[model samples]
Target: MSELFPVQASEASRPLASRLAPKALTDFSGQEQLLGPGKLLRRLVEADRVASAVFFGPPGTGKTALARFIAAKSGAEIVELNAVTAGVADLKKALEAARYRLGQSGTKTLLLVDEIHHFNRTQQDVLLPAVERGDVILIGMTTENPSFYVNAALLSRSTAFEFLPLPEAALERILDRALGDAGAGLGGAQAALDPEARAHLVRMSGGDARRLLNALELAVLTTPVEMDGRRHITLAVAEESIQKRSLRYDKSSDDHYDHISAFIKSMRGSDPDAALYWMAKMLAAGEDPRFVARRVLICAAEDVGNADFRALLIANAAFQAVESLGMPEARIPLAQAVTYVAAAPKSNAAYLAVDAALREAEQGPPREVPLHLRDANLDAKSRGHGQGYKYAHDFPGHFVFQEYMPQPVRFYLPDGQGDEARIAKRLAVLEALKSEPKAGRKGEP
Candidate 1:
């Protein structure tokens, strides 16, 4: 049979790509964190506690496969639905049947809905009661942010399982498996991928495993076998494929997050070369220069901090210039802003401060506003309005050290950022003046 088939299963396996489809959970590649021993999903399946979940991720990241595994393990019958084509009535019938089987045959119903985000609130609302009652195990798959797209009540009933894109190592393993799978034994065909082609395929696929397989299949299927090594895909052939690919940088999909992550990390690593590379990537992919500008401004404040106050000003200027000048010409100011912020001093102090303050806000008491600082605008404020307010500015440098914060709260703990050092020094001097009783200004604690 092996000799006759040259591939196993169906003729689909004869293609280098199709041969590697994992039929079972154990055979699946990538997502070791979910499958590894002591993993949550693995434990849930074994314990029969596989809760209804949302498998969120990029394209071809194995959401369907994982859903199948869950249904298989839970002694359930899985009914698949693509929210795009499936209507509310179909959903109602599907759930009803699943519930019937669950009650009669001890077979729990797992409704695996793909692109759950595409379903309108009406459709999602239909599923809410059943899910809340555990009538059916609702497994939703989406490439979008569930928080934004999913119905709140339904979301509350199910857990969310995030699946990131396959890493390089995992993608490489997928490639190797495709080569070895007898079912997909197109390996027997007369074509071998060169080093450059392999690298190009991986890079172009952008961590999407399905894309890698499909591209590999297309590349081989399209090329006419030449005498010189079965029309091996040269870098040139691979380049053509990549060139033809559409650009979608600001797509707010997985690509947006992935690209931004790479850009920021590259900058943080002090690699201008990589920063520029990602910059070009963002530009090529049509990322909003305004969005990029905003990010730079935030990065300047959060990362660069006081190290280079100029970076902050430049980022803000870039944002303004982008709005005023528009594209083509705006790209210049945007580029300059990105390079400057990336090259500036990196500090996480400001970032950490807000985080710390929020943490404290969560834990500490909400202290009442100081009596003197309370709003006196309304007529209800006639009671001792601005009564204790001392005109300290009349006495000194229009500055008075006062305990304005209720509960002794301190939010702005400035660090030794770019120009922040000068500001910090000024604060210290003012603080010292308040402590001096001779200055007739008692330091307010």
Candidate 2:
């Protein structure tokens, strides 16, 4: 097999991302933590020691770029294969060439595999021998978690490094470089980005360097040059080019937790409009529907609590509906749940009570159950478990008071809000009946 596929495009005709790809490590825009001084990958790259490894991360986080940089730095005979298209036959051919090159001229061959996760177990196992014996340096790139997708044997033989999404500041620097590089960038076109346009592009890119460049390329190439002989990208042009508003909610970033926080707070504050808006944003941004459903369930229990016990039922039904129906359709049920939780009477009494009870339990030794409340089975009675037990049903109003715990622990303090006020009224009447003089001691010890 040929060592490399024929190059398809001329340099001038290449895409912006390909044209501006860093030729050296120093020119790389992001991944400072990995390529910084004393980092493992950097040390390995700098020493020309190419290890069989997997670069795993989200899309557009420099996995393929890093592999290219490694191959360049190693000064080895390199062959790139995409796992999506290449197979075991291609692997064998590559290895055959690698072995011949090493034996003939002592040249190391680096096999850079993109989308390594696409290969199944059987296909992945084919490379173990060469990788284990150090005959070929393997660089596999993937966007999925390697632990779940890659085979154990193959994964064990390779080191895996996680690449994080590029930060906004790093992306800004990349944009600046792309605009100023005369040969490979938009410098020749005298293109300029308006302040708001630049901000929108950065936000919409979601920390992906390739995405930012693509959007910028689209905006500049399509916009007409003004009389000033300069192509200016205004916010309106940027919006039209991108074709979607930026929500800035990344599932792996802090924005995910922050948005959830806002959604729950809005529901708790009884602002249906805000709650629905946040829910819409989350759903539109491709957030997991189950995740949103789970949060809504929690809000129903903690915020709506006993004041509107039905809120829990409604929220749970909505969750079931969401699971049954996936995206686009799931949004309807999710919105329904959000609006219901927000409109329902709000109370956190149950939430506070459970937390208070847990704290008291943790502070002291376990308390014994009072004898009257203990199990009254055949064997339990032998230990005087039900000695003073009086059936509440045998008394007036079916409400005789009796001790339940050996130690007094007052944990539940209802706030007398909504339906909780009714419970408070009933408990007050029961207390009066239990404390009234000798007449109230009919069933007491």
Error of 2 at 324 (Å): 11
Which tens-of-lDDT digit does each residue in 249-300 have in candidate 1? 5466656887877877766665667877877778777777777777777777
Q: Pick the lDDT winner.
A: 2
- Which candidate has the highest TM-score of all? 2
Please give the lDDT score at residue 215 for candidate 2: 88
Off by over 4 Å in 2: 1-7, 245-282, 285-308, 317-333, 339-392, 397-445
lDDT over C-alpha atoms for residue 193 of model 2 = 92
**Residue pairs that clash (backbone atoms under 3 angstroms), model 1:** 8-183, 13-184, 19-184, 303-347, 306-417, 306-418, 307-417, 307-418
Error of 1 at 141 (Å): 1.8
Give Cα-based local distance difference scores for all models.
Answer: 0.74, 0.84
Worst 10 residues of 1 by lDDT: 1-10
